[model samples]
Target: MTTESIAGATVSTQANVYFDGKCVSHSLTLADGTKKSVGVVLPSTLTFNTGAAEVMECVAGGCEYKLAGSDAWQTSGPGDKFSIPANSSFDIRVDQAYHYICHFA
Candidate 1:
């Protein structure tokens, strides 16, 4: 791999793309891809394998999650972190505007 400098800070960018509906995107291959979001709405469905994620909120909003086959959704709001288990996927729903971060490992 190669390294570069940006704005007097050493940072890395592997040419990841931010989805049209999402605010941030990252390509971390250590376990799984990592994605960080801010002021954007994401898809309701997500699947992760061999990894998990930590969700953080800057401007908190209502967030919901559910298993693929389940009809009920687990909900959260402001200052909450949702754990996405490996080998299992989840669906997320948001109510109101928010700024948040998602780190996958």
Candidate 2:
């Protein structure tokens, strides 16, 4: 899989980015190939502010997930998943980052 920066408006002066994943080449010749299959895995402790949220799909492994408040969390293992809409935050452990794999669907 491949990751690319989305470009458009430039409200900010700078940005910091990083990528990590595994991928395979697309079949067929480049001249005739339509697209390739790829996936992404973001395994890390992510902190969102008061008005921030993210949507992620679990492709593999087990991850411990928790919301900003309350005292309960769910495990995203294999097909198990969740979505963090806008204006919410979640805290994940470092170990949770490992064993996450995404693929072209």
Candidate 3:
């Protein structure tokens, strides 16, 4: 399901801005210490490297993504999800605003 709200989370007020403001997010820590982030990528192509494994959950809008070592670009829209390995990277092509939740695994 699409995450509409994050309950019992301690949110960091300062935004994590990247790519000269093309992308931004706020870090969140749940009561049990699970880490997550809610962010948006504006219209641009950007590469993101992960420190931890992640499940990318789409909440609004969409993006085309090409995972590391892959040639195909896949589409992710509202309610869609994708996974990326730890210490890996992925390329995202955003045609419009792509809203997402990054769930650390």
> Lowest summed-lDDT stretch of 10 residues in model 3?
1-10
Error of 1 at 35 (Å): 9.2
When sorted by lDDT, best at the front, the candidate numbers are 3, 1, 2
- TM-scores for all candidates: the values are 0.48, 0.44, 0.97
Top-lDDT candidate index: 3
Preferred candidate (lDDT higher): 2 or 3: 3
* Whole-model lDDT, model 2: 0.43
Expressed as tens digits, the lDDT of each residue in 1-105 for candidate 2 is 312322232222232233333221122112333222223335565553324344444545556778777467677765555666567766654453433322212
Q: On a 0 to 1 TM-score scale, where does candidate 2 land against the true structure?
A: 0.44
Error of 2 at 10 (Å): 20
lDDT for model 3 comes to 0.96
Q: What is the lDDT of residue 75 in candidate 3?
A: 98
Residue range with the least summed lDDT across 10 consecutive positions in model 2:
22-31
Where does candidate 1 stray beyond 4 Å? 1-19, 26-39, 42-59
Candidates' lDDT values, in order? 0.47, 0.43, 0.96
* lDDT of candidate model 1 versus the reference: 0.47
Better of 2 and 3 by TM-score: 3
